[model samples]
Target: MTALGTYVKVWLALIALTGLTVTAAGLHLGSLSVLAAILIASVKSSLVLSFFMNLRSEERVFKVMLGVAMATMAVIMLLTFVDVWYR
Candidate 1:
């Protein structure tokens, strides 16, 4: 497929994911709600990073740096959640 077509498809997928996020938010899943939202957001962000940001075409070092940054963010989020849960 052409780049425009690919972008259109990605845009549609992102829209669908956004809808899913909204639907998930309306439900009463308690602890799982946050997990569902985070998972959906992660998927959306990855799609944006890979397609819109053109990260797939970048060098390995850039990908590695992004990975490190993502990992650090994940750690911080995890720590925050843990602290909140204990409170």
Candidate 2:
């Protein structure tokens, strides 16, 4: 597909994901609701980073930096969840 087509597809996917996030928020899943939201947000972010940010066409170092940043965020989120679970 062309660049414009690819962008359109990604935009559509983002809109669908946003709708899903809103629907998930309206449900009563307790702690799972937060997890679902986070998962959806992560997917959305990845799509934006890979396409809209043009990361896929960038150098290997940029991808490594992005991975490191994502890993650090995951670690922080895991620690927070662990602390909350014990409380």
Q: Assess every candidate by TM-score.
A: 0.80, 0.78
Instruction: List ranges where model 2 is wrong by over 4 Å.
Output: 73-87
Candidate 1 residue runs with Cα over 4 Å from true position: 76-87
Candidate 2 CA-lDDT value: 0.94
Write one digit per residue (lDDT tens) for candidate 1, span 1-87. 238988999999999999999999999899999999999999999999989888888899989999899899999999999999998
Query: Could you tell me the lDDT of residue 8 within candidate 2?
Result: 94
Alpha-carbon local distance difference test for all models? 0.94, 0.94
- Model 1, position 7, has a per-residue lDDT of 91
Clashes per model (N, Cα, C within 3 A): 0, 0
39: Cα error in model 1, Å: 0.4
At residue 62, candidate 1 shows an lDDT of 85
